[model samples]
Target: MENLEKAIAEIKQALPGLTLLEQEPLAAHCSFRIGGPARALAVPQDVSSLARICSILKEHQLAPFLLGNGTNILFPDEGLQELFLISTEKLQKLFLLPDGAIYAEAGVSLSRLASFAQQNGLQGLEFASGIPGSVGGGVFINAGAYGGELKDVIESVVCLYAPDQGLYELSKEQCAFSYRKSYFSTHGGCMILSAVFRLQPGDREEIAAKMRELNEKRRAKQPLELPSAGSTFKRPEGHFAGALIEQAGLKGFTVGGAQVSEKHAGFVVNVGGATSHDVYDLMLHVRKTVYENSGVVLEPEVIILAPDYKLEDKGPRVHGNIVTVNGPAEE
Candidate 1:
């Protein structure tokens, strides 16, 4: 409460254009449609506002979570403590740069990027045509689909380093992209603002055809109609995590409103009004059971945020056998 007030005051003083919300529900911000409330939510409209918000958070000693489209996160049902939720959803901007490059802000959605690329006869981004995350979020996690990743297209990224100065730029190499990680995920000094993507000119019809094919694949393989994070867990080495879970006979396993998608064992969908805890417990069960049966510890792809539990110790408790169920089974 004290920190919230302090943060609000500092933000008002520094960035007058910023909007702040109190006790904002996480369900409204996440794709999972669950979570209690954030201490405060701040939406910065521009680069200057974002920098000032960052400075205010730093001054108030509060670490705000940098949220994107909230397409891949699961918020806690118990809610978060005193923290600010910084949203870049409105910072959307795009430009067709010379030399066949696409420039986009962090808030720009992948769908928009894909559309723009297609319209401009650009190739190499059709794989991300249906990805639900923002460009910044995509870059933060090296988001990928259909054998392509943001890393492959991203030439450089511009980030704000308020702790040091105003803005900084990092090349793709500097981004330190791995499977599902980047420098931003590891080191916390920078926040992505915009990025430059190098694309090649291709036939528009071909790009559209490719996009259509990928979308069809998703429609067939993934449960796109459900409220769920796309993938529940990362692909463990030597085997598909989903195959293992399905083989363990855990598909359609429900905990409250959350269910391991029968269509795709990899996804945990909110069949109804599933709470964060329900999904969390289900993921834990899947990881533990998979490890016990096959000795492969599954890692979740979805990021969980809850006030009561830290990310470090919230996963993997029961493993040996199925225990007493907590939530109701899906019909």
Candidate 2:
């Protein structure tokens, strides 16, 4: 904690113009409306400022956590006193490349990207219209729904690799996308800056219609009205998480103020005044029950950040000589 305090002080002195929110409550930033205060959360205006902040933290042998749209996250009520968070909310650069592909920054929401694609008569992004995460978060977890994933449309990604404070661009194959994950998901030191999406041309009206149809389906099936992280658990290989949960007779079950949604078994909504302990305990019970009922294990889709949650530094990977960030890079 002392190290974190010193690092925070250094970051403030280094970037005087940065918007650093100290002791900010995590609840207001996330979709669940649950979570205690984070020690320090910095919002950098652009990728350069973000990189500088990371470089400062690295100097202190400390690492920072990047908070995206805060959709699929469960931050504990006890708070993160030892952690420094960097929010991508201000990295809102979205445009089209000269080569007819869409360019979006880390903070650009998936819905907005899909809308932009539609307005430009581009297809293939309609499936992401209702996903409540930003481009960075979507790419982190190869987020998909209704038979579509970001990996399918993403052409390339640019990121700042923290270990060396250098920038690198990775192709779709290098991203190593898989079900609900990407290389960036498992690898540390890589902070997503932006991405270029390759999409096909289609009728503007038809694209809009498709997006509307998908959003309507989402609204009907998801517990959007309630305060909850989208889905509590990932889909098990041979079966759906919701189906197995329902089959185990755990639907609509409550622990404190947290309950498996009566509307959608997949969601664990905060009925009212739910604490993080309540949520953690409830999810534990659900996992144990589901595993006992069906021989399958359920993995949480939500990124739970308890007071003790810490990510081990996995060092870094070598990004080839295509671009030397410190030498000559975009950001």
Best by lDDT: 2
Superposed Cα deviation of residue 290, candidate 1 (Å)? 0.6
* Residue ranges of candidate 1 with Cα displaced over 4 Å: 13-16, 310-331
TM-score of each: 0.91, 0.92
lDDT of 1 by residue, 46-145 (tens): 8778887887777766555678999988887877655677899988889898677999999999989999999999999999999999998899889999
Compare the candidates by TM-score and give the number of the best one: 2
What TM-score would candidate 2 get against the native?
A: 0.92
The C-alpha lDDT values of all candidates are 0.81, 0.85
Look at candidate 1 and give me any clashing residue pairs: 256-327
In candidate 2, how many Å is residue 19 off?
A: 0.8
